[model samples]
Target: MKKIEDDIRKIEEEISETKIILPYGVMSITLFDLEQYEKIIVNINREREKNQNLEFRKSLIKKYKFVFLSKKRKLNKILNNLKNNKVEFVPKIESVVNKEYLQKFHTYREDISLKENSRYFLRQRINCCINKVNEELFLLNFHPSLYMNSMDEYIGGDFRYRYDAEAIIYEDVNILQSESHHFAIYTNEKTKEKTKRDILNILAYLNGTPIFLFTQNPSFNRKIDDLYQQFDLLDMLRLRKNEYFKEETEESISLQLPILKNYNNYSVVLFKTLKHAEIVDLYHSSLKQFEPLPRCVFLYRVFEYAASVDYKVKIRPTEYKQEDAIEYYIEKAIGYNPNPLYYMDFGSRKVTNYFTKLKLEARKIFKEWSEHPYKKSKTRGEIIYNIGRNLVAHGGNGEHNMKYDYDKNYKHINDVNIILELIARYVIELLNPGLKNVVERRKIYYEKQYTL
Candidate 1:
């Protein structure tokens, strides 16, 4: 009976030491926390080294024909304690020495395999979620809050103004951050109609009466087919290695006469010849002699022209007094030169005179509001207007210019738009006072046009 018991103990010992056969390429089936698993891998490596040493020692012992006993039983007990303590297994095994011991080992190994597969699946799902969140954040970053708020005003309300808009998308490719916004103003149908009407009115006022005949053929008449043929012939000749021949051939050719197209059908004359072609060409050449002129130069010229008109039409006695009052102011605002020939000779100077006259006319109308005691108290528009004028005249830091620092007060489109609105309002008041009803009829129009 003791011999049978000893045999059973030996079987149990061998079973405990044996490794269970797992799925193909499967090395381990032990379930452990991250730290525990790391420790198990380390132990496995150490045991493998120790086993090699033991095998070498066994070889020496076998050569001497000496009996040897292993301390494996003690090591197995320690390994069992490591596995069993603070660790639980699912699909539990009954005994290590049973006939069904290998089957039980397979069950535990399958459980560990499934657990590992589940961990991998969960990690992938979490990663997918993170990627989706990042994509949404990237898209949202492009649509800035400020742009959306501005767009809301135009998109909503009775205006229902849905015009074509272009946005330049600027972003950091590395960090996925948007940086800038730029927009272009386009003429809508309403704006186009208003511009046409204004142009016709100005033309009528300038030419004594509204001449519908000029509107019929507003643009310069030119035969497109003749121009095309001339261009093609010139291009073909340009490729030839004979400049003398090309010049001689060009001189001999006669261009077809282009019939003038009448623009009488349109309500407004869309084109004008302010200066004769020869004079315009001379003016262009004079402008090219200087660096590009500032916007104020153009504004100054407009003002000069309006002043000239005031000189011609002495209709408004108030305008005459205003003109005398503002003449010195305009001259001082811009340094005056007395050479009439120099003014006439310089195209940029002439353009400057025209723009300045227009601005002065706009300002004169705005100043009329100051006649009322209540209007005089409101200084916001007046202060901004003065700042804008100074900015245009001097090319300084605008309202932001200070002793210690420069501030760009008009940092946004809305701020600049407000200044333009005030200027336009003043212009309308001066040009068409009867349109005061048209201007005052809509409170929302002023808000939409100028709010910052």
Candidate 2:
């Protein structure tokens, strides 16, 4: 058993190093053993009838039958084959990477045009010290792998969830060079997270797209109890294109093309960059005159204030069984003094309606990200954000399992970003005071409720 495990590990290491020149390179198909293979086919056929992706479905069935079928059997007894050994102990890998279904780009790897090379992409601004190290880092595969050999302009990765888009030496770039003594590899796990965050931020920046992080570092998984500086988060979030505005809201007139819909196709939570030029196009050319960082600085301060108050103290009521007592306190606190820290900087007189509006935007974004099927319109996203903001503001409670899930954390990161940027815009307007009536246009759901 040990020898087999060691051999498997060695193979995985070798496979990790091999560059996947995808859409052009061959894909391995079928992984599970014979009995499990038959069961998978049976399970797939059941699901295949439900989805509208018939062509994709048919291709899978054909591929599974031809190559994956280790011991041949008639099609009729597939359900019977699945009946026994239902208790799955260990699911083995099947070489089921079907190329025909995965590949998208028209051009081959070597065939590239000069125009694509000049594509406007965001770049990572790495510091001098960390930039000097030579160790392999990767972008965790958050979405389906895109084809087209644009490694000069973009990075290529395996067509699997959480595969590393490896960091390699490219044109003698100092950051890409591999060194024996990488700082992240040697450091105690807690300190290694900053390095891990930097790598993902750089890749996400360069792509001008949201790239998720999944690294060997244990610190990232441990879940910190207090507020700490995350690596270049604001810059990465800014790259997501027109994130707040939805397709319908923009009155966008374009036909939606059906992407290669297969088993691997997943939902996207995008982060885009809005260039100064894009800001001029979407909102106003006047915004170009005001600097971006000042707004970001103010927003950072807002987070500092949110963390100051103790919103997590859930005391029981004296009179009765207080299962819902914490809920009562939270409701009262938000209605009376939603965020005391928020009022400190911008006086209530000047920014009365603005804070209310910010909460509404956070709720809206939160709802969209959460996709919670069951309805609860009463506790809107804004209220939830305020509560979370207060709880998180107090440096997050690690004890009593106050930690957040991965998906929820990612959604919150994006949602809070939307709230902060919107507020920043209003703050900038406040400084000028020239656009009083115009800035009022940013008002949404909350001010209607709070701002009398």
Candidate 3:
């Protein structure tokens, strides 16, 4: 318990001290992990109340209150007041008198062009920041009073409105300076406080504001690196591609190897640039060309093959006698055992048995590599095979559990697609023995998948 407590304290201290470095002249802000911080704050408050330590509680409360109020005041002081700073001018109305009929009328036009111009400028500023970030930025304005009872009919009534301003800004730019006018919309007293809080939250998350404390220190770089690696933004796009293929063909065939390879290439580029929407579009377009197949049959085959491979590659490997385990499972599941030496031995058995045969084939390949005294123990083919197996057998669910199970298996339709990719790469290498570039293979695979 003491050791655990010490570890927790150390982690908390490290988190508190971690700082991010930004480009020169930029101020960095520290964004406390909001979820964790909120939990801690709530627990502390509860504990103080439970202990009935009035004086101590009051002191702590007063200290935090002052700090909060002071920070709020500083933010408010820095904000630009759009309403007050705006200049208003009315044009003089001239009466046109006609001598022949003695008819006179006054012409008036309220020129809020300056206001409109200022709004446009604000919008441009926002857009520019977004463009810099290279990602989508949405804006929502709830200026009810400005529109509800306005003299100008041009103003829309009290309504919630949202707009997508296509802008992508890097995470290190000053969002406040770039979108100053957008922030000014909440100048009214009714929404000012809420608006300020929202702005702070955005600024904190962006961690790009020049005044942020976190960006000042180099230590924060590792945290940013960890964040980038944590999420697989490419998976959703790949899943969508699989679904599209499933729908188009009426068959849930695993994505073909060539297609998966291409997707990986496309994914690498998109992920590096954060172009998620483009990846989705590419997936839809690619799936539109595939021929349809029976969905049920495709899904069943996928599951059967996945389960067989999972048993051999993951489960059988750990058993006391790997070959015996493979033989036992093959006989039990398929009512037959494979010779493991023949190339066509794969498709001759039940789909599950086929997977077992494929695993055996892979093992043979590895053994051959090992037997060659001059050859490397692990070739690229071996690496790709192992990766493909792990991806299907472990990827999504393995992060949480250490125990192995056959039933909670990698029998998903997508696994077959990955396997196909490995097979295709292997075949391509066999044909082009001198070709050593994975990127070229990836590009070729992508092009073929696009055609499919």
How far is 312's C-alpha from truth in model 3 (Å)?
37
TM-score of model 3 relative to the true fold?
0.15
TM-score of each: 0.18, 0.20, 0.15
> Which portions of model 2 miss their true places by more than 4 Å?
1-378, 381-388, 399-406, 434-452
- Model 3 RMSD, rounded to 1 decimal: 25.4
Ranking by lDDT: 2, 1, 3
Q: What is the lDDT of candidate 3?
A: 0.28
- Global lDDT for candidate 2? 0.29
Mind giving the per-residue lDDT tens digits that candidate 2 earns over 19-134? Answer: 22123222211111223334544554566446534244434444333322222321112222223322111112113222233233222223432212111000010111112111
- Candidate 3 worst ten-residue window by lDDT: 150-159
lDDT of 1 by residue, 1-452 (tens): 24333543554565333233222222233221112222333443344335434334233322111100112232334345434442222323221122233344333245554433423332333344334333323333442211121110011001111112212121111101122221222122123333333332332222112112112232421232122222211111122223433355432221111111112321111233222122222222212211112322333333333434543364445545423423333433333211111001122222122223334443543464456465466453343334334444455585544222112222211232222322322332243333222112222432343332
Error of 2 at 2 (Å): 98
Q: How accurate is candidate 1 locally (lDDT)?
A: 0.28
- Per-candidate Cα lDDT values, in order, are 0.28, 0.29, 0.28
